[model samples]
Target chain A: MKKIIYLDNAATTEIHPDVLNEMLPFFKKMYGNPSSIYSLAKSSKRGINLARERVAKALNASTKEIYFTSGGTESDNWAIKGIAFANEKKGKHIITSCIEHHAVLHTCEYLTKYGFEITYLPVSEKGIIDVKELERAIRKDTTLVSIMFANNEIGTIQPIKEIGEIAKKNNIYFHTDAVQAIGNVSIDVEKLNIDLLSLSAHKINGPKGIGALYIREGVNISSMIHGGMQEFGRRAGTENVAGIIGLGKAIELSTNDITRKTGYLKELRDYTIDEIVKRIPDTIVNGDRVKRLANNINICFKYIEGESILLMLDHEGICASSGSACTSGSLEPSHVLLAIGLPHEIAHGSLRLTLSKNNSKEEIDYVIERLTAIVKNLRELSPLNK
Target chain B: MEEYSKEVIEHFLNPRNVGEIKDADGVGEVGNPVCGDIMRMYIKVKKDIITDVKFLTFGCGAAVATSSMVTEMIKGKSLEKAEEITNINVAEALGGLPPIKMHCSNLAQQCVKAAILDYRKKHEK
Candidate 1:
């Protein structure tokens, strides 16, 4: 088999060896349930507590503020629905950006059925929301503002601090789905005035089924899962001890030297973007270059569909993702791309290559070379090519 | 990505009849870029038979493979016989496409029929 070049790190990452090692003990010797009263279960409880503490420390929050859940999608569902349900009496209005993940957008859409009015603020062509627009969208009855930390498709980071301040001044709860930004971007919940934040472990080289939501100490959010006393009675489920331990270790390792890790990824990302643009004709870079994630590169090649490019790249052992309608199950192009004012044709040709620290310069170089050839060959076969 | 048949992958990686015939007797174009797929078929007819056929397509693997397969299937056939070819035949020739991509085969069939129609329209005068 050919050696693989995995460029779809944003989708999910390989579990770190250290994280796996930490999790293995939980599955074997420490198999007792944390909810059990037996002495054997004490170790499991300790493991969960330590994991919570690590997650809290990464975001500069108290241990009590973090609650474990299934993954980013659940965290998002819980955060948005929790705040919406708890404060509906105060206001039935919620404000969020149009470019959020389906996890958040769908939740907001669901609320409309319950008599809640949601305002989806628009973004600029670069995929950044206008702070003034968000402020203007806020209403007297607005109880929550949910925006994503960074876009998963285009890697555009939002003005989180500004949004947080606006939410704070309006006395509205601020929730951000930080699934894509957690390990790469340093976040301080208190400093940023964030009321709630969501993150997933899988994106940071941890286990797939575990994630956390940080709720500020005084937030009045209702329980998303109603069951036994777990996650301070806010989220109820049997503790995923092994997954928790893995998340703890992964977060610690990723955040311990985030500056260096992000700097290294930024270099590779810049090199990849510059090489692709220089070698290819009519290639348009997506998102804000300066405000984008360090590891993401989204580009559009004119006159060709993204799925063909991805298929040819896969033949070369390079894994990437695209926003083309043909690739996604839905017939429409990516909502995130469309929200940024991209025409449907241009959106269908977009390619996203999210890097990881483990990827090497040699791998990127080979990808650039193959990508240039693939684009050229596809253009030759494209009827739209002139 | 959805799993594709080995034949589909084979044809996509090395699509056949992948260019245009500048002086072709008939041309057919179908689909739009907004839909993430488009195909243009060109044919050179001699004595009411398709002596040569080629295609250019911008789409996913399925779309390109279907266009390639249609061109190969009709190269030596008469215009009326080529018009008789259906999307199902095109799909079966390619071993079968995923259910969602069945439309890509339809695009190929429509393109070929359009080309044949174009050929007939030219000779009607």
Candidate 2:
């Protein structure tokens, strides 16, 4: 039997015990449709409303501002397309960064097909987009500016507050996809002046298939899903009662533990970075060192392919993700790595190791011990070993 | 969880003929850095026969497996016989590869042909 040490927390997280415990009754004894016309439905509706209030409280927003959706992807799609279509008469221009999740990028691209103009803001070598460059890119016809609060691949934390201030000065709506940053960092929607925000439960040790989109009060945005009057007719679907309960519990727990967990993760991340760079030669760490997420450690090894390293890591029962396209079905290097000025070959050698509160120093040491040997073995068999 | 075939994992665990032949008669290197698969093949030819072959590959399990299998398939065979090996043949020889990983076998096959071409160019007297 292999001792599994999972580190791909950015992709998804193991559900917390408290979250699972909260959701079981909804799946078994308390099974009732939130939209039903019976007293049995009271608990279901109460559960969803509690989840919404919890999500809203996490972002310092009003309860009415939080609307539950399927997940981050759906929220992102709705925010971009909903705002673009709703404000088409005002302007058809949108703004985003080059390192957004595909939910945002693809939605922007989808709108471009329908005659919507978008300007993708470029980033620095450390993966931080320039505020002045953003201000310059904004035109009178720009309707919205959507930027990620923290990047998923490189883990760069953009200046969302400053970007929001710029948008407010121009009276453009500001939306941020904070899926990766929600539990790992502190966020105050009121302080940041964020108009719209997207978050997923699974990223914070909650159940999957449930998320929330925070819309500021009185924002006249159009709806994307239009079947039932669920989600206040914004997104059309019967509410996921079990998943919502899980999310609320998960959010409550993670918010309380954020300070201690993030502090520990940052220490571990920095230690890992220091050790890898010191022990391994020709390594480049991606993302801004100070402004990056506490749990993300993205590094590139020269002359070694990431898929080979990942395969070898799997043999050692270590789970991580690679930016290389060979393992994934994509045919190009990670766009985030490339956007940060990495050469194509260097980008192919990148690895992302995201952590969680469950991780320990012993696990980190075990990874370091195995990774050193694995990199040596792969580099020996690599064609780039010149 | 286990996306790789048993044969692919076996070959990757213990790759054969992995090294560069210093002062080799012919060498071929091919890869697209964007896709992160690279192959370097070295061959020793005599009397139009491939007396020895070696491959160094930087890629996934499929790439390492295909390289090992391709080298084992072509050693001591005539250059003409070795040139007939294709990506499909290498994949079939190792049970099979996922559709996305077919390019790994393609890299092996292309490297063999490329090494032969390099051998022919140098000997065109």
Candidate 3:
């Protein structure tokens, strides 16, 4: 097998060895349920509590406010649906940006059927939303506002602080899907004035099935799941003890070491961006250079299609994703790219390279070399090529 | 990145006969940017034989590979023989594309048929 250079960290990260080690004990000796009253279950309960504390501490929120769920999608659904259903009679209006993940946007769309009005906030060509526009979109009937902290596709980080402030001043609840931003950036829920924030473990080099939703204390949230008394009866499922321990370890390590990790990723990301621009003509970077995530590089090579670029890269053992889901079941390009006013051809050709702290300079250089050749070859093959 | 044959990957990376044919007798363009796959074909014909074929395709790896393969198959063949060039033969020629890409794979054959039809409409007079 060829050596692999994994740059598609946005899809998911490999579980950290430390996180995996912390979780190993739970599956064997500490297998008792946290909900059970037996003495054997105390270790599992302690593991869950420690994880809750770690997640809460990472966001500067109280332990009581952290609620665990399946993953980013579940947390997003719970936050949007929880607020919408809870305040249905007060006001059916909900506002979310058009560039959000399907988790948030789809949830808002689902609410539209329940007589809940949804307003999709548009982003600029650089994928930034104006604070004033968000303020104007707020209405008396608006129950909640959900905008992602950073986009998964373009890596555009929205003005979450401003949006949160606007939501607060209007007395509306604000939820942010920070699935892509949480580990890479330092986030304080109180500082950002966020009412609800979602983060997934796998995105931060932890286990896949566990995630947390930060609901500010005293925020009204209707439960998405019923029956079991777990998660304060908010998300009723048997606790994923091993996954929780892994998430806790992962969050604690990532946040404890975030400054260095992010800085390193940023250096590599900028270098690659510069190298690609210098080597390839007619290529344009997609998102705001400075405002974008430190680990993300979305660049569009003119005339060539994204899937072809990805395929050539794969043949070289370099893995990345087209920001567009074009090759998949959805023929349409990425909504995030389209929302940013990219034409269909440009959007269709967008390639996203999300980095990880583990990526070395050598790997980055090899990727650039292979990628430059691939782009040139594809462009030559493209009819629209210059 | 499903398991594509070496031939498909080969043509995708190094496709043959790219670009447009200036003042070509017949032209066919198929697919939309929305669908994320588009193939434009230009053919030069003489005495009922396709003298030369060229194509410009903007699509996934399979689309480009299929387009290249179809052009190679029907380049010197007569219009009637070229009309029989199916996407299946293109796929088989390239050792098969991923099943999901089979839909966009047909864009090459469709464009070929359209171009031949275009030639017929123009020369029947």
Candidate 4:
């Protein structure tokens, strides 16, 4: 059997066994609609409620504030559009960072057609947004400030609490797309003064297509999906029962011992980063040295494109991702890397290897071995190497 | 990788005629690194017949595979015949690249043509 080493946890994670076990009954025997008022429906309703509670607990939010969505994309769309439309009367301006995930950036772009002014704050060379710049970007009509808790590509953790504080002082609602931050970084919505936040289950060893949005009680955001009374009438459609259950169990397991889980992941991440930089010449470790996700190791190899490296790695039973334009399905390199001031050529050579608890020291060593050879070989085949 | 044809993956994994011809009669370079693909082709022509061809590329799988395939396609062919080879021919020879990767084939064809053009320019002078 081929030995597969899955390292793209930020893209999505393998479901935890415990989460899968908890969700099994919901998909088979206890398959009842949560909206249906019957005894069988009680199990489904209980499952959703528990998942919502788990999500709320992780963010230090109240159960009433949590509303399940399809996933991070939907949650991001809901939060950004909901806040933008609802507060249009108050103000038509929104502030966000340049390095946010496409989920937030595209949503902000879409809002532009509706005459909602947006300020995309630039990040420093290390991909950290300037808090003072964010403060200055805020206008009197800036009704909301939306920034991602962490970047999906480079894994740079933004100063969300500082942004949240600025938004609070300016009397603007703050929303954070925390899809990549869940389980990786500890966040408390209350302490951060975050009015709206988006998170997904798939990033933390849970099922895909299940996520939650946290909305402060007094915040007046309009519902994104409407037709059914599910999710307190904020979101509509039949609940993803099994997914919700898996998310509940996954969140509980991941957050129960966050310190230990992150500590172990950090050791692996740092080791991998250090080894790659040391072993390979002309290799750069992207993102901040610290204040980044514990599991992320983004690097750019000089003189070779990323997809070729990814292909070679894939051949060796390794799974990873890249910020190269060829892999992006669009012919543009990662905006995050570009925003951080990397040249287009270097950005094209970017590789993102996001780790998980399942990864180990041995796997990292093997990856270093294979990666060193791949980089050396590809550089030999590169025209720019001359 | 699934989007790539088996031929593309095969060619990419074992790219042929890689590296440069140090003292080649003609050398051509095309495409930009900004677009994530840059291909350089070197050709050695003897008595109006292509004697040897090699390429070096900095790009994705498609770019490398296409460069490899084009070099193989034009290696022993006459300059006139190699000049007739289009991007379509290169892509077809590799069982077709994805629409997004068609540019790689174009880069390959352009690179070969650029080398041929260089050969012709030197001789024409």
Query: For residue A283, what is the lDDT in candidate 3?
Result: 87
Candidate 3 ranges beyond 4 A from true positions: B1-7, B14-25, B44-47, B88-100, B121-125
Off by over 4 Å in 4: none
True contacts kept of 4: 0.94
Lowest summed lDDT across 10 adjacent residues in model 3 chain A is found at A323-332
TM-score of each: 0.99, 0.98, 0.94, 0.99
How far does residue A243 in candidate 2 sit from its true spot (Å)?
Answer: 0.8
Task: Give the docking tier of candidate 1.
Answer: high
Better of 1 and 2 by lDDT: 1
Error of 1 at A328 (Å): 1.4
Per-residue lDDT tens digits for candidate 4, residues B1-125, read: 34888999999999999877889999999998888888999899998889999999999999999999999999888989998999999999999989989998999999988998898898895
Report the alpha-carbon TM-score of model 4 versus the true structure.
0.99
Q: Per-residue lDDT for A191-254 in model 4, tens only?
A: 9999999888899899999988889999989988889888888899999999988888888888
Lowest lDDT 10-residue stretch of candidate 2 chain A: A324-333
Candidate 3 C-alpha error for residue A273, in Å: 1.0
Residue A164: error of model 1 in Å?
0.9
lDDT of 2 by residue, A1-386 (tens): 88899989999999999899989999997788999989899989998889888887888999889988889999999899989999999989999999999899999999999999999999999999999999999998899999999999989999998998999899999999999999888899989999999999999999999888999998879998889988877778888899988888888888877888899999999999999988888899999999989999999998888887888898899999988877557778888888999998899888899998789999999998888888888889987887
Give candidate 2 regions above 4 Å deviation: none
- Each model's TM-score for chain A is 0.99, 0.99, 0.98, 0.99
RMSD in Å for model 1? 1.0
